[model samples]
Target: MRVLAAMSGGVDSAVAAARMVDAGHDVTGVHLALSSNPKSFRTGARGCCTLEDSRDARRAADVLNIPFYVWDLAERFRADVVDDFVAEYAAGRTPNPCLRCNEKIKFAAVLDRALALGFDAVCTGHYARVVDGPDGRELHRAVDPEKDQSYVLGVLTAAQLAHAMFPLGDTEKTDVRVEAERRGLAVARKPDSHDICFIADGDTAGFLRGQLGEAPGEVVDTSGEVVGSHDGTYGFTIGQRKGLRIGTPAPDGRPRYVLDISPVDRTVTVGAREELAVDELVGVSPRWCGPAPDGVVECAAQFRAHGEAVPARADVSDEILTVRFSVPQEGVAPGQAIVLYDGDRVIGSATIDRTSARAASPA
Candidate 1:
């Protein structure tokens, strides 16, 4: 089958494309140009979209003897991912740009274009699996737990999963590097990209500030006592425990965490660590990989990347999904993804809208 591999000039993707070639599938490598004006990329213990990365991807494609091209999605990326990220922050909510990129750019836009051009599927180096289940194609976490990326991909819809391919799902990262080395690929030793790719310095706060400008606000405690002042409420996120200039010390001298960010009042509220625990979350814009389940369904819900999945029940109502955790979860933040799973298979996901206060008594 003809497949278009989304190469990001990284070792994982290079090896993924090579593996597809080895499997006797017709493969084409395409690097997504997320930024129009190239600058010095920051790796920050992770990989970056640098000129070197594009060269590395081309080299790998050449070694595999496959056609390679760079598709410029800079404008779309800025609008769909970067701008959305800034806007979410300005609204006092933390947004995941990677998830947005996967949902809007990779799956929606790129997949549509590929299908129109007669490609059977669009492949990527994402560390997630897609398997035929009882109902239909189901997504699962990668074999390698540390590198599993299902969280970022939970936003994919059923139609998107139909033509998506993840060649590195069952393979380990070490083995991928080995394959790249054996294939004489130059990116075998290339490091993985960490944090947001467009944010060169990993300064999310600074990036948000630059986009939204300074909106000075007051930092208050749970009791509405103004403890300090901040440049903007966008600079803070739920469960953030550091960089808060609130001069007051906790009773035990432990740091306080941001419990809530009120964009309407331009205020950030801090509380003790205990206040971060949440037992229920309400999500908006739910997307299912397959058919939406009926009534309250038991599933594993993941709130953050690399975080553990907690047992939960989801009540889907059109565009809104409400998830109640079996156990109170700490750091449940609004605007983060709440991905649902049935064992290893991904059921669906939603963007967290708000987290309800813990129940007075366990039901």
Candidate 2:
């Protein structure tokens, strides 16, 4: 089998490509140039896909003695992932760029191109397992829970999973670095990338401001009293607590969290932390890993990438997914993904659209 290994200039990906070579699958390493201006994407531990990362990937591929090439996907990434990210935030929803990258760029674009070029499968260093279940190929959590990345990959469909490979899924991060060092790979000591890759300095608000510019707005309480002001509604997200320039403190002396953002009216609503809790979620653009569930299925829903999975009942109808949590969840912002799981197997994923909290009883 011919395999296209995506070497991301990181320890995990280098090791994954080496394992593919050792397994005797005619392997070819490809580094994705995601940013046209690589210098702007940051180097070192903070981010990835920069000029330095591409060079590192090439050197790693040379060490493995595999045919190497670089695929420039900057335009596609900007249109699908970067642009979508800013638009989602501008519309008052928190978008997960990692999930969007996996859905639109890696799995969709890369996999399509790999297959067209006659590659049997596309392999990566993602810490998620692809198991051949009785039904078909199913995506599962990695053995190393601390490094598991299945949440961001829950957007993959059945066909994509069929031709996807994660050679490092069962290995720990420490062990992967050791293996890379043993294989004479320079990136064995490379620091893992974190935060948004495109935002080099880790200042997300500042980056958004540069793109969307300043649209001064008022921060009001739930009762519609103005308490503070902000440069733009895009700078705030649901459940954000700090950095709100409120002139007066809350009457209860407790910190206020952002409860809502009306981008249309440029108004941000603030309230107590308890006001952020919601028991119900409605999501759209559902993508299943295997078969779609039948009617309402008992499952667990994960809102954030590393967030705890809460037991919930999920129902899909008319291409919409609705989940009811047994326990109310907080920090569930719209435009984020709601990934459903059956124990360790990924059931499906959907982009959160809205949420509802049951009315409180008169105390």
Candidate 3:
């Protein structure tokens, strides 16, 4: 089998590619140049897709003695992931760029291209397992729970999973680094990238301000009384407490959290922390890993990438997925993906459209 290994200039990816080579598969390493201006993006051990990362990937491939190439997907990444992130923020929703990158770039674009070039599968360093269940190929959590990335990979379809390879899923991060060191890979000591890759300084508010210029707005209470003023509503998300800079103190003398953000009216509503609790969620654009479930099914719903999975009852009808939590959840913002799981297997995922504060009933 011919395999296309995506070397990201990181310890995990380098080890994954090495394992592919050891497996005796005809392996080719490809580094994706995601940034149009590599110098502008984050550099060094804290960033990815920069010029330094590309060189590191090439060196790793050379060490493994495999054919290497670089593919520039900057335009596609900008249009699909970066632009979508900005737009989602402008529309008062919190979006995860990593999920978009996996859905639109890695699995969709890279996999399509690899298959067209006669490659059997696209392998990556992501910490998620692909198991051949009785039904078919199923995505599962990694052996190391701390590094499981199956939440972001939930956007992949059944077909995508069929041709996907995660070579490092069964190994721990520490062990992967050790294997890389033994294989003479220099990225064995590279620091893992954190925060957003595009935002070098980690100042997301400033980055959004640059993208969507300042639109002065009023921060009002639930009763419509103005309490503060903000440069832009895009700087806030649901359940944000710090940096509110509210002039008027609450009568109860408690900190206020952002309850709602109306981008059209340029109004931000602030209230008590309890107001952020949501018991129900309506999600749009559901992506199933395999066949859609019939009737109501018991599952665990994960709101964030590393968030805890809560007991939930989910059902889909008319292409709209609705989930009812056994207990109220907090800080569930729109435009975020709610990944549903059955034990360790990923069942499906959906983009959160809206949430309700109604009382939760037993599932």
Best by lDDT: 2
Superposition error at 153 for model 1 (Å): 0.9
Candidate scoring better on TM-score of 1 and 3: 3
For each candidate, the alpha-carbon lDDT, in order, equals 0.87, 0.93, 0.92
Best by TM-score: 2
lDDT of 3 by residue, 1-363 (tens): 999999888888899989988999999999998888876334432558678888889999999999999999999999999999999999999999999999999999999999999999999999999999887899999999999999999999999999999998898899998888898999999888788877766788998999999999999999999999999999999999998879999999999999999999999999998888888999999998888888799999999999989999998898889999888888999999999999999999999999997744332
After the best TM-score superposition of candidate 1, give how far the Cα of residue 298 lies from its true spot, in angstroms.
0.9
All candidates: CA RMSD (Å)? 1.7, 1.5, 1.8
Candidate 2 residues 1-363, lDDT tens each? Answer: 999999888888899999999999999999998887777334433788788888889999999999999999999999999999999999999999999999999999999999999999999999999999988999999999999999999999999999999998899999998898899999989889899988877899999999999999999999999999999999999999999999989999999999999999999999999888999999999999999997999999999898888999999999999999988888889999999999999999999999998776111
**Candidate 3 lowest-lDDT run of ten:** 38-47
**Model 1, TM vs. native:** 0.96
Model 2 — TM-score against the truth? Answer: 0.98
Q: Which stretches of candidate 1 lie over 4 Å from their true place?
A: 40-47, 359-363
Which portions of model 2 show Cα errors greater than 4 Å?
40-45, 360-363
Residues 205-304 of candidate 1: C-alpha lDDT, one tens digit per residue = 8878888888888888888888889998989889998899887776678789999999988999998888888898899988998999787899999989
User: Looking at candidate 2, what is the lDDT of residue 334?
Assistant: 95
